[model samples]
Target: MSVLRPHGSAFSGRLGWGRAPAVVVVDLVRAYTDRDGPFGLPDPEPAVAATQLLVDAARADGHPVVWTVVRYAPGLADAGLFVHKVPALACFGEDAPGHWGELTLKPGAGEPVVVKQYASAFFGTTLASTLHGLGVDTLVVAGVSTSGCVRATATDALNYGFRPQVVRQACADRTPALHDSNLADLDAKYADVVDLPEALAHL
Candidate 1:
């Protein structure tokens, strides 16, 4: 690997893909996907597009697919401290418009949709146990706001004993600086930051 920035010392290595892998698409709802919405951005589409390929690959390979969505209660009762940090998150309320609370990347009927109140799919959710029940040993993590949800999920995957393969192209943020930095740190310590093709090929 080319060294763009130096790590003080080696603290991590590639966990790689396991035989049983599942794809978890995190927070690609319309609120973040549509340019007219509050958290929307132009560059997130590429990540969404890349993730679509991984989803297809996972389905074809007969692996389970899980999609995570962030939806706050009517009064933002479950949003916790995040609501105070980013008031724009209120736009993801259940009453948000069709193009706001909806998922940009639609899931198949059999695929599971895990609604979350926070960033990481694992945080205060049945995600970890669900994956365990499905015998999913590796997590193919892809989704929006790479610096937030993507990074959080990847880190949590490591802690939860599941190998997280974070597709670099299948993860995005409002700013490239945030996306790049988070992925760099995740690669150095938590997950294997890989290209879309590389991840798909492995799966």
Candidate 2:
């Protein structure tokens, strides 16, 4: 196999030119990131750390920082076909303590949390309006399941007229291959895939 080059070089010189940017943490909740939770993948601690760094930078720069969690009402009626397709999600019902993660924002950090039911935070949520209200034109995205919620959120961010920046190291999937493949696809078609250090440099 050819040596895989870092994604940072791909967006060199195109980094920090947006009007106002925000960091969007999509579905980094316990149900997906915690090892003991039902739909949890492997340890997502590293991804969480990377996301924390981005969150810190965004808050320091006075940029909006939004956190998204997937919440479903009891009985799974609110989850629709998603729960049926992936029965694991049913564990994140409204009353379930496993619905959210241990990593949460500090009080009065940046912005309010956007609770969502779908993979994309922009779908059926106040995320767009929140960003718009914050005057955010660029979106720096981080979260769990690089191939699922992260990808979906990035794609929808692009569609919503926000420049989506997918933090390569701040996202994870069940496997490394899926994470790498989805990052490549997002870089090619949806958003700019960048590493944590490079992203910080841009900011």
Residue-level error in angstroms, candidate 1, position 54: 0.5
1-203 per-residue lDDT for model 1 (tens digits): 87787566766677978889999998888878888779887677788789999999988889999999888888888889998999888887776555477888889978989988888999999999999999999999999888899889988998999999999999888888888989888998899998988888877
Compute each candidate's TM-score over C-alphas. Answer: 0.92, 0.86
Candidate 1's clash total is 0
Q: Compared with the true structure, what per-residue lDDT tens digits does model 2 show for residues 111-188?
A: 678877888989998888888887888899998889999999999998988889999989989999999999988887
* C-alpha root-mean-square deviation, candidate 2: 5.6
Cα shift from native, residue 44, model 2 (Å): 1.3
- How far residue 118's Cα lies from its native spot in candidate 1, in Å, is 0.9
> How many steric overlaps does candidate 2 have?
0
Ten contiguous residues minimizing lDDT sum, candidate 2: 101-110
Q: For all the candidates, what are their Cα RMSDs to the real structure?
A: 4.3, 5.6
**What's the CA error at residue 37 for candidate 2, in Å?**
1.6
Instruction: Give the C-alpha miss distance for residue 159 in model 1, angstroms.
Output: 0.9
